[model samples]
Target: MSLLDLDHDQRKELAERVRQDYEELKSKDLQLNLTRGKPSSEQLDISQRLLELPGTEDFKDADGTDVRNYGNLKGIRDIREIWSELLGVRYDELIAGDASSLNMMFDLVMYAHTFGTQDSERPWNQEEKVRWICPVPGYDRHFTITEKLGYEMLSVPWLDEGPDMDAVREAVKDPQVKGMWLVPTFANPSGHTVSQDVARQLAEMETAAPDFRIVWDNAYAVHTLTEEFPEVIDIVTLAREAGNPNRFWHMTSTSKITFAGSGVAFLNTSTENIDWYASYAGARGIGPNKINQLAHARFFGDADGVRQVMRKHASLLAPKFNRVLEILEAELGEYDVARWTTPSGGYFISLDVIDGTAARVVELAKGAGIALTEAGSSFPLHKDPNDRNIRLAPTLPPVAELEEAVRGVATCVLLAAVEKLGA
Candidate 1:
């Protein structure tokens, strides 16, 4: 039957059927959660060797520096080399550091607001207000970091190529616009990759704020679900070619690659920016744990090792991703009630329901004994302007559970769409 032709009675009957099915499923009380982007236990098991790599006798690096010691402020060389390849930049451009690259990103914003970037006329903190361009359907944590620092967020629409370049150009022309937060590779929530052309255009922009740096967070650089990989713009190279040498700050972590809380992270940027950052960061801590760095070096060794590990992750995660997609396709593909992304790689699939229906869909899913990432969690300040986007995280749950959870979500979507259309 054509969905468009369904009368009020038919729609009401379908909604009632959905509710009945949901009640039956809820009676199972099957506690299932698909709300987080964490790797499954099986995926984590692949890196168990990392925990056993460091024994009393094995506590030294390639240069014979005691791993137990604490003097390598810029991180051990071998770890830098591993992340250098993982991030697709030169070893010199990367600065391997402690486990949280997010922390480094936070510090960069603080630095800009206080000390300012290489070409700033004055400190940003002294200004009346500072603004940051945030691509909607972006990483919440990235948005939170800037918001916590009191920077005004300007939401820019995220398109297939990248954040709207036209919007970005116009926004950055305002002097108060200090920077932009970008997840260029396999962006969080949406799982979208910024195209090389977009990257180049971003690099070439003539912002009114001289200190405006693109906070490029390449968290999922190696996380791919398809054989054909997305091309990363090598923003460092792009900035140089654009003659805006200090225009980008790149970050990545081995958190997903090795272990979540106990992995190495790094930052890459122009030498001048690095020098300015180090002047403060160097004084803040003795150094990152060099021992862990050496262990990761020994574990992955090179780009090939990193790729091998990623393939293992792909094998474990691909099934769960496929299950969600399959269920969504089977149940909802016939209807124009909702749409979702088929990401090549990344931790999430962003779903967009009929306008103004996302919140109701989420509520229905919860009532049916399934939990999802809250509606509007993808946008800055937890507001998707159209109220349509929902982030689906398929990595945390096992495939069987994912299938059931997504099916429940599909029912909720249809019911919500019908109700909205009726209203």
Candidate 2:
């Protein structure tokens, strides 16, 4: 019988069976982790050539500026130029930084609240409270950043096309809504690419807050598993054309493309925003590590080289993704206890279990010696009111381990669903 259709006694029996299986599995000394959205060792190896690019007297920019010494607060010119091509933005509009674009975004919010942006009439701190529109089933780190800053977060349901634009429009009408976080291309966890129509509507929407900006974190811009994926219209261009020139603060990084801990990151926006942010950012530090930028520039050479590198990543990752899908199909297809997203590209497979069962499933998986990202992490404030969403990361583990992990997760889901129904 399906877990949902099981009687109380049957469910109790099923739970006991699952518990016994988990105990046996845990005692097998198997080590498998499928929690974080991290790339595998083989994926990291693809960019190993970057380390050799800046050896034996090659540490200067084209203008004779020493790459090792710090001065350009907005990054070296050539590095910006390279990223501009990758991000589909102009070089002058981009501000390349160190490996942490997320850190930069946090600083942006903090600065806005304390001192405001160039266009603001007053600092956000003087206001009653600042608010942000958080799309549900989004990146946990994105929500955590806003919550930690004490900004009032309003959760908006994310559709396959993107976030519900109607809700977005209504939310932004409130004067306290200062910003919204978005991952437009193959978004984190959900892997839903924002539709072109939705992108345009978001750009053109009227907001009561004059300084409202879209915190567009394109963390997985080029990390695609399939060539048949939808093409993302450059939101910067769309926003500018829609007469909202400063509507977006775009960010990207090579964390997944190169070494996760040491890759370069960048932000792109309108000229006015760039000038203001540069002036503010310069007060703190001299600049990002130019040597790293030079190394990446040499390693990738140009945009085409970067695309070639992504193809290698796709080859390594596609099978792992398919394996998870295969296991899900084999174990849970007929029972219908949950549904999942089959993304064309991106780093995650988002699963939606029965309401109020996700936390139990995660606990059961842990008992079986398999780790997962904490349940409800995909939602704002780590609160999934329905307790339904779970993000499955398949890229980090080997194919065999991923298969085993998927089976374990499937078993957990069945156990949890059955118990919930019985209760």
Candidate 3:
């Protein structure tokens, strides 16, 4: 029965039962974690072949460019082509960089703050206020970048297909709203893929700022749990057709697909934006790790090779995701105290416990030696306005440990909900 439907005495009895369950959970003294969506050791082992790639003596790219040299600011052609096909960008427009896409994202924000975008009248720092549109139940690191820069972040509801279009369209009417953080496909926690209609609206919408931009983070472009991959929108082309040529700064990486510690990052955008980025990026460094780029290129011979790798990833990740769903349903469904996403692809399950009970659930998990991403982490500035959301990562732990941890979390969910009910 729904907890709300239960009588006072029933609630008290149920609370007592859950408290006993909580005590049992703590007594186990388990040290399991579901804090970050890191790939498991088995998942990591799928790409061990990367170690032998572009072997020492065979370090030259297909074009015979020596990868060890400090040149090729645009990165190697072969690597760029593979990602271009996968990311829906032209080969010439893509720039392969070092491991982390987060680094590239940070750099772009700093670059814009100091130098402005290709279309900007002045640097972002010179402006009085720079507001960013952040889709809630989104990526935390994306929010952290703008937060660390002292910029204001506005929250927008992320619907099943994408962010609430009407809200985003209105937000951009203010000149202070400069950029937005978006993960177009299989988004971080919610796994809300942006539909073509939404993508077009974002591209075509009129805005007050000439320099309005979107950080098109395709972090999970090919990271699908299902066999059918999500569609990739031709965003840059759509923007150009809409007369907003420099509207997006695309970023992607193989950190999850291959070796997380050593992976190739990609940046794709308009021709003008590329030129603008190169002028500034060139001043900062000679080039990215071309040797590493060559190694990645050799590992994934083509676009299909990347998809094939993602399938291996799916084989390992799908079960953990399923187990979490099954546990959540079995433990929390009857009480109607929790709801979660059943994602076709993505690393996280966006769990929402009873209203105002997320922090309590997380706290309860912590007391029982289970580590979860902090409550409210999915929002800008680490604040969930309703305090109703939690991001659960199931990819990192073994299925056995994941099941136990999720059961503990479900127990905490019930305990917290009942506590809130009594209050």
Candidate 4:
């Protein structure tokens, strides 16, 4: 029965029972963690071939450029060519970088602060008050970058079709608002993809700042956890068609597709934006890790090769995600106190538990030796106004451990709810 349907006596009885279950759970002293969206060790093993790939004899790229020597600052031409096809951007528009798109993303943010974009009036640091729009229930690290850089963060609603563009349009009216973070496909925790119409509206919308940017982080372009593959709207094309050619910047990496630390990352944008980033990045380093890029290129020789590997990833991930949903349904479905997203792709499932109970849920889980992503982490400055959202990552744990961890979370949810009702 729903918690709201319970009588005072019923609530007290349930509370006592839930408290007993929780005490027994703590006695188990089980150590299970669902904090970060890390890939399982078994999943990592699938890409082990990368270790021995692009062997001693494979130092030269298709252009016969000796990759062993450092010269091609734009990354290996062959690798760029493959990414261009996989990412659906012009060959010259995208440049391969070292692993970690997160690293590349921070670099771009810093570049804007230091030198500004190709069309900025001045460096962002020169502005009296610089700010960026962040959609709620979004990536925390994105907020961390803007926050650490001293930019005021404005939170907007991220609906099923993407960030509420109406709210986004309204937010950009301020001249101080310089940019917004867009996770166009399989967004970090919510798993909502940006619709084509929303993409067009963002492209065509007028901004008070002439150099406003849309930092499109398409980290899950190929990481679908289901059989159906939905195509992402061509944001670059839409932006250029809307006469805002340089308004968007796209970043992606094979970090999830291959070895996280050794995979390749790429940045896609207009030639002007590329030139702007090149000037800043070139001065920072001679070039990216070409050997690692070469291995990735040689391993996934073409676009189809990339898709085939992603299918393998789907096989491993889909079950873990399904298991998470299954546990939530079995334990909390009838309560009417919780709701969760059944993501078709991506590494996380967003769960919204009873209001004012998420922190308690997390606290109880931690006390029971089951770690969850800190409550309110999905919001800016780590504050969830309602204290209702919880992000569950199920990939890192084995099936048995994941089951136990989720059950522990469900128990806490019930106990917290009962306590909230003064049971």
Deviating ranges (above 4 Å) for candidate 4? none
Q: How far is candidate 4 from the true structure (C-alpha RMSD, Å)?
A: 0.9
Q: Per-residue lDDT tens digits of candidate 1, residues 1-423?
A: 545668878777877886677777777776778788998889889999998776668887767888798787778888787767766787777888888889899888888787877689888888888999999889999989887888899999999989999999999989999889999988988888898889889999899988888889999988998665566567997898899989999988988888888888888888788888888888788888888888888888787898899899988888778888888989988877778988879899999998898999888888777888888888888888898999999998878788888888888888887777662
Cα lDDT tens digits for candidate 3, 161-193: 899999999999999999999999888898889
Q: Candidate 1: where is the Cα deviation over 4 Å?
A: none
lDDT of 2 by residue, 1-423 (tens): 466676777667877886676667677666678889898999999998887887769999867899988698888877787778776787778888898888889878878888898868899889889899999889999898888879999999999899999899999989999999999888989888888889889988889988998999888888889764346467787888888888899998988999999989888888888888877788878888989988888888888788889889999989888889989988888778989999878899999999999999899888788899999999987889999999999999988889988988998888787677764
Q: State the lDDT of candidate 4 residue by residue for 1-423, as single tens digits.
A: 898998888878888999999999999999999999988888888888889979999899888888888777789987899889887788988899999888999999899998888889899999999989999899999999998989999999889788988889898999999999978888989888888878889999999999999889999988899876768566787888899989988999999889877888988888888888889899999998899988998888898898888888899899888988899899888877789998889889999988899999999999999999999999989999999999999889999999999999999998888888788
Scored by lDDT, the top model is: 3
Q: TM-scores for all candidates? A: 0.96, 0.95, 0.99, 0.98
RMSD of each: 1.5, 1.9, 0.9, 0.9
After superposing candidate 3 on the true structure, give the runs of residues whose Cα lies further than 4 Å from its correct spot.
Answer: none
Please identify which of the two predictions, 2 or 3, would achieve the higher lDDT against the true structure. 3
Each candidate's number of clashing pairs is 0, 0, 0, 0
Ranking by lDDT: 3, 4, 2, 1
C-alpha lDDT of candidate 3 relative to the true structure: 0.91
Query: What is the lDDT, from 0 to 100, of the residue 179 in candidate 1?
Result: 88
